[model samples]
Target: MKLAAAAGGTLLVSPNFAFAGEVDNLSIAWTTDTASWDPNQRLSPDPQTILKMVFDQPIDMTSDLKLTPGLLTEWTLADDAMSMHVTLRDDVTFSDGSKLTTEDFRYTFFERVNQGEELDIAVGFGTVSDIEILSPTEAVMQFSKPSPIVAQWLSFSASYVVSKAYAEKVGPEKMKTSPMGTGPYVLTEYQRDSRIVLTRRDDYWGDLPSAKQITIEIIPDPTARLAALESGTVDIATELSIRDVKRLEQGGTLNAVTNPIARIIYVTIRADGVFADRNVRLAAHHAVDKDLLSKAFFGGDAVTINQPTIPGMPSFLPDFHFDYDVAKAQELLAASGFGPDNPVTLDFATTNGQFPGDYDIARAVVTMWEKVGIKANLTVITESQWYELNASGKLPPASLFVWENGTGDPELFAGNMFDADLPFATYRTDEVTAMIKPLLKEPDYDTRIKGYEEFNQYLIEEGAMIPLLQAIQTIGYRNGIEIKPWANGLIRPEAITIS
Candidate 1:
């Protein structure tokens, strides 16, 4: 098994996570709306506030999910880091009072993540080849493919364990309407736009969060969020603008905790998307000013990426990352037959739940392109709508889209986008296909790195998605919450403490 940690290149660590300590009853407000309670669909920030409420991620790859144990008790890897065997504590039970079984594990993958467009993150789950349920408390997962990061990727919330009983009654479609899981908190009320309320399960099987009720309010404006924090109207507000960082730090009522995310902020180029030709893709790549967007809109909170995968992933990221040059952009633009008269304009749209301040990012990117004689329209859509358009090719007739790199395993990234037949996003290349196929099933180490390097370089040469700045997902808290930053990009609510 070839385990190359950060085979891509070296990444600089952010000092923000070296926390001072924990705060109590931390309050937070979000700019996005929560339309679905179904854990299988796009999960909102509100659901996340009750860390253990809605769903618990499957702790093991082989068996049905049981909220038995996590991180601490036991996990073993075949010295090569290719295959992992997980052990669960027999003591844990779900909020519904049922014992988790391996069959439930089979149902989640065979039924949900593997089939739908919504939960394709299973591309990471595809690693487990065979499973032998040793009992209700133990299981072994064989990797059809050797991937060192499988353990870290298993930590994604998409793999959340669902109650088979609830899924059967509600059906997967309606279950999405109101989800039920073995989490620590239970969804009490969802007042659209106003608030989402959760109550701590008194009999929670895991470490119980101190707060009895987790209420998340919706505050769209950044200024209002900051004001609420200062006035004590809210406890935790997400996304601190660069301009207000100092004020929050100085104010007695609020404290800011900033950290870099394992996720990369990027513009995905569709392979078979409207602009499939290499020249057209390259034209679009050169047309945008990633640096300006990073500085002006993102306020320099983001680091630029040389390609799709984030820094320190698996391949060598180039140093070509920089500002958008109009002349060069025009040269590529003209060469692609997209001229001033034949001006190219695309609509950039994203769902509210997926990213912070993405709508603003859309507008700012538009301004960057207009300066280069190109037009970019902005639209803010729901996650479902965004994915629908992305899958159907309706959104970017040309538009702006950011694909968070490294959130899933590498094959899912390449297959869902680059595979001509089954891709969920856009873009395709024979070169991409060849590199991905062997890498998907290959268990060799150095060979996998070679495939990744070829693919990374192909992205630059092909100019698929204009690789934008790699940025951290920022989460701000009031004075009392203590939390650890996720090195690979995730916020597990149960792990946070409010004093």
Candidate 2:
């Protein structure tokens, strides 16, 4: 096996490997299962990881998180930032041997807009008004307003293109179970909450994947995933805890790889109901010791974050600080007429084993909040349930959630989280809505950064949400299996090589 330099100068397995022919099988133990087969119907992290294998996006991101071409060969944004022209690859074909053209791209982006239907992945296409098909391989995307981040959106989640004829024939309901796309792999078998099997297409348009067949077993527990990797039940195990990764590396047969991705683990505080008061929200924010949580759960592998944006991002605030003070938290709780004698009680939702150390970190934060006279009833829920509740705007007072920002764009991070119109916004207020609307459409780079900096300062003052820590992607695999770590944390089949 060859070793190459990865992000942060970490040594990882190189994609180049001497092989005679196609490898037979590659089994992986995944932390979560995909909620939907349709790529555009779901906006969560787990589904995107699986859907990317079958569907090709307009633009792709390199392992280092740089933009590259996927389905579209070339894309150029207009000078006014109101439109974008994209040229698709004419050689690509779906698994059923049908040519992939601009018609599929048009339907993938503008079909919902034409029917006046609500889009599940609204953030990517909120400003896209129309897609004018120039030819079989070219189209122009027209936006309702200036959209500077339109190119970046092409590489984000829910941006994958599907076969237009197949989708229209099957309709939306049947498309969820049976989906077709122009990609390297085809979804051969799917068992909800259990397993998924994908087979490589022999006539794929791009480079063939190393494995001829891929089996992904949905194992939600971190310990179970580690066990599977150790017992040789699977070749690769993803989303393992840092402690498990350290243990695996200490042993000889298994090796561990880790990369800090563009996702943030934070607690969302509802703007209404029990947390309607800003002082109560501030108390919750002050109670969490982000640095301590990082050390205890992640073994300092993850970096603590003060805001939604992380380091190296455009909207990252270096000087912004939200101190952890038990006294301050208690004082704020008292101001809200709650103390040790009459504790402030509320329900807190979190998922177990969805990500590395998610459950442990939530428990630690709950314990910290208890010290400040806040009685939080922590409830463990599934990822699907969390999404359902979030969409209905019925989440509890506080919920632990992970926001995936693959593009590292500020508009997708802070902009979507605080935008009053988006369902992801937990702290929706007239002031916050007014503050975020202008930053979304600002085409000037420096001006947009300045506006986000001011908006972040306002969010800190108002205690909009509790930003905990940046997430790290950890995967453990056997000696013979080679995998390159992506900065976005997705385990692509094409990036895996078997010896």
Candidate 3:
């Protein structure tokens, strides 16, 4: 904590007292993204960075986190992979010294689903009623209905098993301050809205690190984050602007890398807004050249995409592609009664100062729309207020939002967003709800994939949500740390090793 005044009592205090362990030759600089540092509260990429320190278990993308062999290894899948029975890995224990058990998995899922903290993945397991504990180390997970994706959902870190004993002992609010997970790092200190410190657990079940202690300081300014990364104060930074891509170009020990980010940024139309008209929507789609905006704004790191899910992932239907069509766009608007006399006026709420040159992109979009007779009003908000407004679901006028679920499963991606019950866009669709019901129940992989492709196509063709650019996830680090590259930006923390 640092003082505000020249001599003292008026100190503008911070949470982390100091970095844990010794500062090593290789240090990582990253920003604390959210207002808080609770793992359960983490819904964005920022939280994931910190979560790596707090949890040591490696994820096996090849198997479901549930009923898999890890902290809790080996499980029984029924005749179909739909339901599973698993046994915990023996001898695993929490930092608090509670033995790992089936109850941990059971309670964690039940808690998150009820709390709605990490429902992005938990929605797949919504059918499971209870976990039957046959013994301390063993249990059976019976689903209300068979779900092939249950394991995939469980594989997410959010569904990670927590020590129920510690959680109850710590209590909810207290647990936020003192989380005990079976990871490489132990939560040592957390200052609300400021910073957090984690120390490598020497007694941790899995392999830890040569670095020893990891401190995550919550720096909101991406520029500030970049500065820290360059100045040797930080070892890694999250969400750097396209300009920073050039900043690192001058060359240093620092390196910048990009991944096909799970995040797909798109424009959302308010179901109740003026864009509710189909022609108004499709015309608006064609009016903006996504390719130009992505190139100018993202520095060639993004692809203009139409599918609700990421490209190359399961159930991704490349059948539909959206491109600029000026003539057809005008015709669609004319057919739908939207004309220059009664121009389609759009109010778009996007960010300008947040990312590098975001305002320019917003302006470019408005300019494109104007040629087709759409009067676009773009309002810029700071990143904080933007998210606050987004969380409220009343996306001001129109809004630009990004979704970053890296599971590579289309059902979870498209189904989670467009699915009426949990439309993150805040738009509701009866057809979407109908489409997902059968899709979720199909047991055959081929059938499921086919159904997913069809639903994604429908979402695109119907303009359920405006499609925009897909971001390649970028992670900049010093040369010492190693990262495994997957099409998805998510790196299994367990697989990471510092050289």
Please count the clashing residue pairs in each candidate, in the order shown: 26, 0, 14
Stronger candidate by TM-score (2 vs 3): 2
Q: Which tens-of-lDDT digit does each residue in 136-167 have in candidate 1?
A: 65566667666555554554445566666667
Error of 3 at 113 (Å): 4.6
Q: Give the Å shift of residue 415 in candidate 1.
A: 5.1
| Model 3 bad stretches (over 4 Å) | 1-27, 34-38, 56-59, 62-69, 76-82, 111-124, 250-253, 339-342, 351-360, 381-393, 423-425, 479-482, 485-499
TM-score of 2: 0.92
Query: For residues 1-499, what per-residue lDDT tens digits would candidate 2 score against the true structure?
Result: 0111123223122222233345788899987777667788777776677888888888888776667677776787876778888888778899999999989888888875467544565567868899999999889999999988877888898888888899878887877888788877898988988889999998987778788988999998878989998899999998888988888889888999878899999999888876888888899899999889978888888899988888888878888899998899999999989877788889999988778888888889889988887889999997778867988887788889999988888888889888877778777888888889888888777888899988877887788889899998999999977777777878887677676
lDDT of 3 by residue, 1-499 (tens): 1101111222211111222233343344444444333455444554665664565332334311112234545555575555677666556677777677777777775655555553443555567767788887777777778666665565554555667777667666765566678776776776765666777777776544555666676776777778888787877666677768656745767877666666677777666677667787778778878878878877877877887777777777666677789877788888877666667887887775443445677788788877777888888776567657757765675666667665667666787676655536455667667888787767677788889988888776776677777865555666555555444444444433465
Please give the RMSD to the true structure for each candidate, in Å: 6.4, 5.1, 9.8
Cα misplacement distance, residue 173 of candidate 1 (Å): 5.3
Winning model by lDDT: 2
Error of 1 at 452 (Å): 1.9
Q: What is the lDDT of residue 244 in candidate 2?
A: 88
User: Would you list the rank order by TM-score, best first?
Assistant: 2, 3, 1
